[model samples]
Target: MNGPRERGRPGGADAADRALDDAVALANGPATARPGSRQPSTDPLVVALGHEPAGAGPAQARTRARQRPDAVAWPEARRLARRVGRRLDPRALPLGEDLLGMALARSLTALTDLPSFDSSAMDGWAVAGSGPWRLKGQVLAGQQRSADALLGGHAVRIATGAVLPPGTTAVLRSEHGSTQLRTDGEWLHVLASHSAPRAGQEIRRKGQECRGGEELLPAGAVVTPAVLGLAAAAGYDELTVTMRPRVEILVLGDELLDQGPPRAGRVRDALGPMLPSWLRGLGAEVTSVRRLVDDAGTLHAAVAASTADLVVTTGGTASGPVDHVHPVLAQLGATLLVDGVAVRPGHPMLLAQLPAGGLLAGLPGNPLAAVSGVLTLVDPVLRTLAGRPAPAPYAAPLTANVPGHPVDTRLVPVVFDDESAARPLHFTGPAMLRGLAAADGMAVIPPGGARAGQETAVLDTGALAPAWGSGA
Candidate 1:
């Protein structure tokens, strides 16, 4: 009763007729169906030719791909981000007291030699002769007295850091000399046990630590509290350092609440409150944070108008109905330097070069995924822009086995236990932040995972102050 099947048609005339009717109905349906319904076609050829299944379209396919991203390897994503960051020009900032965490743009040179003048190293008597000596006036620190030459049997009481008078010989420490009243004013008698003083004992000579114009710190040195002290001691009133990379954060989502608890499908904006401080820790100066609704035009305008060196967009990176990042980037002629990263919890993340000479980092909606994007892309970009050297790769043995993705790298939060091994923490799902909050660092697990006792690279999270010289 049924006619022969047409080419590309699996069933007979009845099935073919039904398929054609279904295709026609789909062509006439809404351009974008409900969230749960099949997505519409993004490919014009598929719609024009009407060859796809009744409900399946290019848009649907794209959306599915986004849900499970076709990503590049994690290392490649980091390289791309670093390359883009290195292209940015380094800006010089005045080295003020607030320069902590900034990288030195150039080598810091000493303006004056340390211990610019010969000074006493302890509270002592500057003696010219070896035996009993006549006492002269005292020399206190900062007193600009004349450099009177001392006679063969003369001595002057000098305090630590006091400039040594001309023609002074060995110094007699206070405990090593006895003072007595004699006919010729007061006299200082060196005790027999301490009579012999080394030629330069108790004296700090000029330029002992560093000479004038010597390099105190090299370029790319991170300014720390001790660096500030050293700069001051080296007679430097200001420093020339690389400026922190300026960043703008665009928090996107219609279902995000600015404050209060999550209710009725709306969750509090976690990234908004957390990103600013985190970016600062990464050497970025966050300029502003704007919460945006899911509007393509608005996002486009925001991206085009941003003047910051980098713009970080949170959420809407996928190809879902509410996801508008890709289309906007396409319209603006931006280059997708990193389409996606082969890393768990943040596989949908992307990095793009905005047409306006700025870079854009797209973070996924999930809390943990956003953190992953920060470590994988934002950290490297900001570090490079700040003129900081790439952190040396270091690894720690794993105390327990960590599950890994078949093709992607896994960044699992871990705590260092008593055995000095990184122990993986649980509750590290893409949407959760509990594990990250309790973790010290993230263990980078390679493909196929690692067994217990395997050495894995640990990414510092700025969670705790690093041990002295351990570099985290």
Candidate 2:
């Protein structure tokens, strides 16, 4: 069942030579320019990613603006991400964690007939005809069906769930029938008060539920726990399930520590530890989590070498000196599919297609901003590739005022109120995660912001906390 992804090459690792060429282009790509409008940062990455930096002067900004693609709207960016993944072929994966949460690639068929044998459904007497009959044999659950066929006026003492003997027409339940030993091979009689057993009474006939090879569930059915149980009963040891999108997370920044508390200006790595599980929950198979410094060449090599369906890089998506995502993409001849998004906190987030193969999502440095990028880009792509159904659109009224960016949409982490209104949480700045940790979902506030009692679309975060979470 294991085969290379037929999207062509079993994609992981591109040739180093191509990566080197890309690196060379990165080294000499942007011309050295004096700081124009904003003081600290330059215009290379931002301009290339279609963002007008806060510091660029009129002439320089105008010059750079003409060479850039406009940042995509919040909704459009997500749509682009989904579009890129539509071509990925689903796989016939064997059942396991790999299959968990993935849609079935094909219909699940019954491997064997349901109740493959004629059996007793309860503790009863298997009879050939009306009783007041001779007891000929005995049968218990799991015992072989009687080799001798039953004759008229004869019965077998059968336990619950026992396979009924051939030629048996009906079952007389033990409680409704009485036995006597007047010799002549011990007789069985139906209690007149209970009446005689009817035809096929208490005898579970084979294939009554479903016959062999019948389709039990249609293709596109999700492999839930109940499905697994049903599959086991239908003679399946493994399930043929849809492939999960493979993702590789690259945590960028030299000022990030792999462990220990923040020290010497370096902060503890948050995305590295969290993205793997988060991506898994979103239906992507996180293949690897690599920690790298903010070096263009390292990022370039890593991106080029990855065979994952999607490569996610945290930090270094802006126009800072350390920002290398844009430069690397330019060198690699990659198409900036969703060059940048107009959402707050993650306005610099980008989605790109590597020429070698696969896609990359560039998330902003701040934890919360990175999360926004995931929702805007990574989540949509994975869903399409994994064949997961998109959640139904939903909205909730706001319990309090939610501030918004004038021209950009805001994704505010919120808890539900007593009336099921979405209550915006505090500490929801781009760099913070505290508010998100306490949130049930993110309320999508339009450009003008949302007022109390105003209904706004809410994106499900999958963590539906209890009513206690509804409190401020």
How well does model 1 score by local distance difference test? 0.74
lDDT of 1 by residue, 1-472 (tens): 1111122322342343233223222222222234554434533213323333223334533443455466766755776687686634545555465787777888988898898988888897987866588999888899976657888889899998899888787788999989999786999987878646767778888899889989988787778778889988887778877777889999999999987899999999999988888887777778999999999999999999999989999999998999999999999999999988878889999999887788999999899999999988888788677776554333456788777765566889988876557889999999999999988777777655677876555677643432111111
Q: What's the lDDT for all of these models?
A: 0.74, 0.72
TM-score of 2: 0.70
Candidate 2 worst ten-residue window by lDDT: 2-11
**TM-score for each predicted model, relative to the true structure:** 0.78, 0.70
> Residues 142-198, candidate 2, lDDT per residue (tens digit)?
775454789998998888878888889999988998898984669898888998888
**Residue 212 lDDT in candidate 1:** 93
Model 2 misplacement above 4 A: 1-69, 86-98, 116-136, 141-161, 164-214, 416-421, 451-455, 462-472
| lDDT for 454 (candidate 1) | 61
Candidate 1, superposed: residue stretches over 4 Å from native: 1-69, 87-95, 128-134, 150-153, 167-178, 189-197, 463-472
Maximum-lDDT candidate? 1
